[model samples]
Target: MALPENYDYFTREQWRNFHGKNQLNTVTGDELAQIAALNDRISLTDVQEIYVPLRHLIHVYLRRYHQLVEDKADFRGETVAPTPFLIGISGSVAVGKSTTARLLQLLLSRSLPNQKVQLITTDGFLYPNAELNRRGIMARKGFPESYDMEHLLTFLDQVKSYQPGIKVPRYSHQVYDVLPDSYDVIDRPDILIVEGINVLQLPTNQQIYVSDYFDFSIYVDAKAALVEEWYLQRFGVLLDTALQDPLNYYYPYAIGDRQAAFTMARQVWQDVNLKNLREYILPTRNRADLILHKTEHHVIDKIGLRKY
Candidate 1:
């Protein structure tokens, strides 16, 4: 199970061996089994092999963070401030980043009852459709340029400052636009999980990078071929279901011939998603605090934790 010397991340067998020795008391086998039953998307084997270990690792990190705060306060002779632990989750489209984010939020919250966990998607910071159309980057919706980086950074900075009742703008996928007056408030949570496709990518300038605000970051990694297949599958499912809704943003796409719809989805993946992943997302893998490397079946085969 030992990984190759040159490999920075764990292999599947290595992770299993590691987990065998450092099991946490927080979540039990029964609880994990129960949770697995709630979602058929991931198998029990994946949950035990990947997510259980991940949950334990996150708990360890949180424990260490609290200790560091205490140590710093004692050394500096000042009261320790309550700072939010920001964790960024980034991955390519259809790589299951959303699922990972949601699961982490659930696991982390259950690990410590007193700690508040908030999950925020970067979609809300995307520029309105009008702006994207005007900029002639409508086809580049998920690209880095499509987001309001300045506003996103500003919001993160305010969160770091422990600002009270901070409001975050909302984006509607149904309308594919930012809601003008709608917002959500972050009421000073202990941890914030910021999930997005390009969160790890550095800004061209120093002022507005999401990584600047992160306490820890994770990148979900898989081969481009696997992700492309998943993307196509998801598109097919959406075409069969959600696209049929009259109010669905992608209604027009759903009405197209199945073969035509599949072709269009592939083109979008190749031209836009894959391009952004290569130029922006994948390049930032080195910046992550941890990397979850997945197999062809979307099971996390190993974890790569950055050395201090």
Candidate 2:
């Protein structure tokens, strides 16, 4: 399928060739497995060919961002605080966004020797289970409205303004709930990767969007059918691991009939995750500065770069 008109589309080989003469650092097989999400496929060659070039692009963007800040300071003849470059990664739940965000964070941090790059997933911004129950959005957990949009916007605004001691709530996948008052502090960073399924969603009723603070954004793309397969595969893995613990939210599925568990996974994917992707996530693909289109086996076969 053709990409949107505004994009300069390139096949995988073509995109790989765009990496300049510099021999960029590559992730080893062990490291790839460490950062890779369960059920997704990514090799060192993929890192060298795809993520290295992407790191170079982000490096250029970071440099230009600092330069622009300096230019503005000079124009005003006043000192201004250095700004942290925020990058947003958005995609469907099972599309490997966590892996992508972690890859970019690692690559960017290593490539830039003098700066600190931090990665955060906005799952932290989700409302607590009790709140969701009260609001009657438990079934719509990953939907845009299910998130604490107001708090998310405030967090981003503070980050953009270079605020310190900013604490973000953490969500526990094992329990399938937000850990109340448990927080991750984001100190001032040179670059921050803010990733989530709804990161690139359009502006909501609020005057500001979570993406308004983003200087650059990425959308991971793949067929919904393939993503559903991945979602099921991941659920199975969790049953083997996370569900083994009685405290886990999925323990019921783990001890229940295996076929029934599979059935439930499919139902949740169709009713919740897939619905959110179709109504909210996929529509934001074109808004991304870059799109990574994945094919079978989670291989990124094409890249689409926006011309403007």
Q: Give the TM-score of candidate 2.
A: 0.97
- 22 in model 2: Cα distance from truth in Å? 3.0
lDDT by residue (149-175, candidate 1, tens digit) is 888888898888888888888887666
State the lDDT of candidate 2 residue by residue for 1-308, as single tens digits: 24677999898898888754265665667887999998888988888888888888877787888889999999999897879999999999989999999988888777776888888898998889999999998889989888888888888888888899899998899889889779899998889999999888754687766677888899999989999989999999989885559999888889889999899889999899988888998888888999999999999999999988
Worst 10 residues of 2 by lDDT: 19-28
Candidate 1 Cα RMSD (Å): 3.8
Cα error of candidate 2 at position 163, Å: 1.1
* Residue pairs with backbone overlap in model 2: none
lDDT of each: 0.79, 0.87
User: Top model by TM-score, which number?
Assistant: 2
The residue ranges of model 1 lying beyond 4 angstroms of the native Cα positions read 1-7, 19-40
Clashes of 2: 0
